[model samples]
Target: MTIRLTVNRERWWNHVVGVADEVDGLIPVVKGNGYGFGRAGLAIAASKLSPLLAVGTVHEIVGLPDEVTPVVLTPTWRPPDTTEPVLTVGSNDHIAALRGWQGRVIVKLSSGMQRYGGNIDLVAAAQRAGLRTVGVAIHPPLAGTDDDHRQQIVDHLPDIDPSLDVWVSHLFPSTYESLPDSHRYKLRLGTYLWHGDREALHLEADVIDTREVRPGDRAGYHLTEVPGAGTLVMIGAGTANGVAPLSDGRSPFHHRRQRMALLESPHMHTSMGFVPAGDPCPRPGDWVDLQRPLIHTAVDELRWI
Candidate 1:
């Protein structure tokens, strides 16, 4: 009836627990559609390791279990409703605005990513502003080399106080092993923790309807041309579920590298794929394997088995 995300339970859980055991200080990040498992679900999953959960906003903390303490990653104007949320302040202005909040704070430093955080002066300003600075957060870029990432951390070490706890993202295993023994380093893991073993996860959407299409026939919202005679296979997934539209004339057909009919861009809750006249076409009710990540797509149900 809808897109379903199936997880190999044993494999997935083993990976999850393995990450928790392998990492010394693990702060599991459960944000952004919960990286496909949903935030609340991942929150429960991570509770076994640590009571701490990192979310994108204060709003995401509502449904989390009482045992978990949420750390809000982004700057927010709204106060947390419950769970004594830890606030992140990237700039002096942010720290100044959050002066009313008496809860623990983590000063985010500007790594090479440049998305958030401030210079060393802001960290000092945060402490001076009466904010109880408990930890320092650093989010590194994903594309950089090992040397580049290590240098990124080394560059920020002088700015960070050794007494404060350190949290990092996108850090390599080798980098974690080499950290100074003096500081308590907690790695903020999300995709790498949940989706690390890609084999453990599978995505599939049901084929709902099929129809014949002839060359030059009008179809879809914009009346996209049907290049040739084929069967149009409509699948249960669309933009509403975070399915992205085709880009740069790209389609699943290009990625699959097959000679079958082209797969068109998805609709709001449905997408059409052309199966050429000569090729075997999938009948309605069959499922189509999806290449998209669950984080980028919403589904009606999840099968954890």
Candidate 2:
């Protein structure tokens, strides 16, 4: 039993290189399951594009190739145990925490997202401490348009030193190119880089078991009644594999180009989905298409074709 991600290697690699060529200074983000390719794999792939890579935290810095320099995106109050990766400082407290460290740091500026980041003044404050201020980071909210994000970055330019590099996220390629070239800009991209060519990627899970059920038949852990006389297809993906119902509560499993109904909530390592009486159903050894997002899923195998 397995959940697998199949990739068209040629198309996927072409898209990766294409994005690298289009973006001026692309800092490939290799964090949080590496957008489904896994972090180690992304780090290796990112090495071919840029020397610098951005990760979600210091802990993700491990297992990276020596050629790639990692920068931690999350703000940390305590200094990282290793000074290898550059750290992000968003507040005075964060800056003060690493006052004596001689490593590089990126000062995060507050933006529309309001998730993490400090005022522009934090840049100078980090320099005042013993840390080497390498760049300034701006993570704009995803809710706004590219123009809005560009304006937000422009609005902070006067206060930030022009010499320091500007790292930004959530901007379209055209919008990023529209920014002033006088200042250096590095776009931290993850989703756009890896998932740009969705047609090159596919996800599927194996049918581990199946059972014939009648309408009103009690089944599953909670003894939920069967909705109709159909075949109960037990899928190999479940909560353990980040397989859950869609946000709207629809089943994430699909068969024969039709969405299957969930028999009940997903359990540890399997989910039960029902195929209607007259609909096409998958046998125990067959595979079913899964509709869950790759970033949120854990696949048993990754096959590159």
Candidate 3:
């Protein structure tokens, strides 16, 4: 069936705002399928709002439209001839590895976050070399506030140059907002753009069919039989759609129809059926919006619409 339903990019765009204005600026986070909104789409949309925000890495930067102003998380090595990203940093031999870069860059700070930032020594070296230390990002303590860690940062940076901007905390938008001023230093926001303080939005595929049956009748790749008279509705987006389950712990289908996952079972055929708007119950050849939450999971396997 024709999956013609719109993704409601506007709905997503309209909701792409901060919950509060107390913060200084907006930095939309773009990572992992742009949180399923698609990188290019969200980047283009976010550009309409703020030019500054954070992208996870160099790969994400390439997907961004030129209009996108970026603070790439930790820019990978680039030749000096490669110039575009406004800010990003490196550690170890990162500067030499960068070959040559003209845009602004930050020395990644290894605070409580043990990810790909910098240590105090790296920051010192960057400063001595006169590399632009636009900011230092503290990516950790994500689970909760760490007052001792905050003080530790204060104590640890005693010799740090004040010209280096402090970008202490950056997590989901809510966490960024929750951080006390001492911890906020400079909050980096990601999930907050699509999911501010509000609860997550859910999508569910619908079961289009149920049938009454008995012991012998067979269905699906395994020739499984219907235990009872129940209908099988088809609901699944295959390779064509970005429905492939992700390895990341975050499950996009948390609220989606459970059957969507079942359809992927190798033993069960996942084709579905549907009718277009104002049409009769869909027969084969009818168009449908499988992307629609409720309608996606209800059709029977092999029941192509």
Candidate 4:
């Protein structure tokens, strides 16, 4: 069965170009289903708009065509053959290991993100190795830190390298835009383009089949029972297709919207759930929201047409 997804293609392309222009030269991130637009579609779009290509890892490099300079956010395990890369330095030791290697590279400095990057000392080592250091980098915290992350980096940046060719990182647009033009080097954007700039993107899946359930009938795993006399509509797509809707209380990303509960009947790999908002909500062969509206949901299945 096929679950149809509506593509806001014009809005997407316009956003990509708009976002890229917001910064000096955008590094279009084309990793992992191109953040929902499909890698090929994103790569082609990014190639046309961005000065450099942004990708999650080395594996994603295969799809990009020539003329696009690719930047791999992954630490330097191997430099891909497609394009010369500014290898991401995640640790001080990795910088040491990269010492004596002559190539274009970016030092990934870690902060509240606490994920990937090197530090000030790593910069000195790179200079010593004769590596053409084009950028100072930091992947910002997911919480979107209140100036702490960038401030910390800015405090240390002068001491690291005052002549950085590029200062690459991700940040909320407010933060990114506030960056003094002199200090801001490059912006790596993903969510803003493939997804929406704000809490506006929507994802929907097709309703497949609906069944009437008696008040006490058992359903799915653990012998869960149907609570009322209502219709259970089977969505065309399920968890196997990455349509499993979910939420947790710890963060605002989840608390703001509703997610479909999991269903186990048919012993499925993908997921489809009985809509809590049934009848008036969705009809079989009709499209229904599979993810929280306005909240950034991870990409599951995406096909751009």
Best by TM-score: 2
Instruction: Rank by TM-score, highest first.
Output: 2, 1, 4, 3
Residue-wise C-alpha lDDT for candidate 4, range 107-141, written one tens digit per residue: 77667666666566777666677767777776666
**All candidates: TM-score:** 0.93, 0.98, 0.64, 0.80
Output the better candidate (2/4) by lDDT.
Answer: 2
- Give the distance in Å from residue 38's predicted Cα in candidate 3 to where it truly belongs: 2.3
How many pairs of residues collide in each model? 0, 0, 27, 8
Report the lDDT tens digits of candidate 3 across residue range 137-177. 65556555555445545654554566665665544444445
Off by over 4 Å in 2: none
Candidate 3 Cα outliers beyond 4 Å, as residue runs = 1-15, 18-20, 63-68, 111-113, 127-130, 145-159, 169-185, 197-213, 216-229, 239-305
Candidate 2 has an lDDT of: 0.90
RMSD to the true structure for each prediction, in A, is 2.2, 1.1, 7.6, 4.4
Reference-based lDDT, each prediction: 0.79, 0.90, 0.50, 0.60
Candidate 4, which segments miss by more than 4 Å at Cα? 81-83, 96-102, 144-146, 181-184, 197-202, 249-272, 275-283, 292-305
Query: What lDDT would candidate 1 get against the real structure?
Result: 0.79
How far out, in Å, is residue 266 in model 4?
Answer: 10
Q: Is candidate 3 or candidate 4 better by lDDT?
A: 4
lDDT of 2 by residue, 1-305 (tens): 68999999999999999999999899999998888888888799999999999999878888999998899999777776778889999889898889888799999999988887888888879889988999999999988788999999988888778899999999988899999867899999988999999999999999999999998898999999998898899999899989999999999888888899999999989999988898888998899999988889987899999
**True-vs-predicted CA distance for residue 219, candidate 1, Å:** 1.6
lDDT of 1 by residue, 1-305 (tens): 58788999999999989888888888888888988877778788888888788888877878888898889999876555442889898987788787767778898888888887888787788878887888888877998786677677777887677988888878766678687676678888888899999999988778899999888887887778887888888877777887654454444322133523445667688877787787767788887776676778787788988
